[model samples]
Target: MPVVIPAAELGEFVTALLNTKIPDPDHARTVSDVLLWAARRGVDSHGVARVPRYLELLDSGEANATPELSFSGGPSGVTVLDADRAPGPIALTAAADEAVRRAQAVGIGAVGVRRTVHTGAIGYYTSRIASQGLVGIAFVAGMPNMSYPGVTGAAVATSPLSIAVPTAGSSPVLLDMATAGIALGKIAQYRNAGKTLPEGVAATADGTPTTDPALAKMPLPLGGAKGAGMSLVFELITSVLVGAPIVSSFHSDDPQGRVHRQNALILALDPAAFGDPAAFTEHVSETLAALQGLPSTGEIRYPGQNSAAIASKRAAEGIPVGPKVWGELEVAAEKLGVAVPVTPGG
Candidate 1:
């Protein structure tokens, strides 16, 4: 069972825990906000569930707490950021801000980030850009944790992609997804819950598909070759472009190489640069209306719509933390000498 805690309390608790390692208060808050944003929207796999793993990385010196991030301007509307092993949210937020700023100056802007840690919920960064009235796109690549379509072992990173488009309404249309059939964090969630994985989603060490969570070694691509191909292209655009290719550098042979290194690319476009902003918003709203009006057996909600609704509801009620996640949080809090947020019933 999961326990419910106020969203604000959860955020405060997470920020305090992160502050223990991350010296910069703003950086710690940014990381905590990103994780809690995912949790509030029901993306539990990318949410506070990752706190324990992040703590491990920080304690082991695999992830830098206060990295001196550097940025250099490229061609018009282009920028590259050297994360210097900083946490993903910190690097990503900086890149997104720069992208939005450049987009405001020009018609479009792109930012590349290299040598960052695990980028939790790429949508969070994109949606932030969208909230600033710009179209946002983001992609991230890391060390291989997923198998290539027909390969035996892990070959490529899951490689997530996210896009967000602003609309007249409060919520933006956002699409955030991984190339793998299931995210690595979701696999960990399944293992924690003692549940069997869905068939065809993962394979055992011997290269055979397995439903047993314990036996699952690597995740399969979403649509076999199609998803694998997208992941490869993402790696090229992100890692290779940023001069930090993860797949080529890290493999099972080099376990430590997989610790805390990733690359990301973000783009922002202003609708006003192309045409009238009002026209773009009207078109998007009409398209969404048309899609909703289409014949359907169930609810027809666009991407990010349900997530927005979930976030709102959870904000009013409370964020749900599963027993396993709560237990891990407790252990982390105790180790760091921080107090955990108290649940309603407990």
Candidate 2:
């Protein structure tokens, strides 16, 4: 049976396990916080289940436990961050902070990050910027794992983007999505639970569409060509612009070309830079209220509306961990000599 663990306890366990691998407390804390943020919001695909895989990355030296991040080009509201293969959460969080700082100084701030590991839930970083009353936008380009419309095999990254706009008297309005019809994480989750995937979402290694989770090797683009085009544009803007192309490198013949890496672009726009920040948030709230009042067959929810509600409920009721993920966490705890949290009635 699955278990429900308190948010605080889960966070502590994840942090402890991560600390055993990552020497820097701040980096570990950022990663744990982002993962928990996703879980609390009911985005289980990018949640704590990723811990075991992240540990593997750290263990294999694919992710630098302690990264020496470098920054350049602060003038003109633009910056580039070289993460030195730091875990995504650590590098993206730092990029968001830098973007916010620059936005506060000028009207806008943009930061491009290069050579980071899997960026878990890009919305977490954008939401951080929204918390400060600024509009946030982020895009990530990574290795090829999604099929393009005309390509046979995996031909493009399931690149993701997120936008967050602060609102008055409520949670921020957020939109987080990937170019693929379904994320690769979702396929892994389905396979772990022995569930079949919906047709057209995924394909086998040979590009044959498959509903069997075990055989599904890659996700298809969201709207086929539209999604593939977006993924390509994202790669050009983020990876190519940053001088670290991932998709191209992954398909290259270079011995080390297939090494896992990702690049991202984070931008922050201060409401105060254009008009009164308070008025802007108030208007945003009004717009959401109008959207909620619209006629619908079911509950009308904006992008992040349901997620905020889920987070509140999980905070009080505890987050649910599937049996498979719980077992994995238990194994990691034992390996690290860290105490696992006892789930209620477990």
Best by lDDT: 2
lDDT of 1 by residue, 157-243 (tens): 889999999888758999999998888788888998899999889887665888888888888889999989999999999999988
Candidate lDDT (C-alpha), each: 0.90, 0.94
How accurate locally is residue 154 in candidate 2, as Cα lDDT from 0 to 100? Answer: 90
For model 1, what is the alpha-carbon lDDT of residue 2?
91
Candidate 1 whole-model C-alpha lDDT, 0 to 1: 0.90
lDDT of residue 110 for candidate 2? 97
Residue-level lDDT for 312 in candidate 2: 100
Clashing pairs in 1: none
Candidate 2 Cα lDDT to native? 0.94
Which candidate leads the pack in TM-score?
2
lDDT tens per residue, model 2, 1-346: 6699999999999999999999998889999999999999999999999999999999999999999999986577999999999999999999999999999999899999999999999999999999999999999999998888878899989999999999998899999999998998899989988899997899999889999999999998988899999999999999999999888778889776789999999999999999999999999999999988999899888889899999999999999999989999999899889998877765
**TM-score of candidate 1 versus the correct structure, residues matched by position:** 0.96
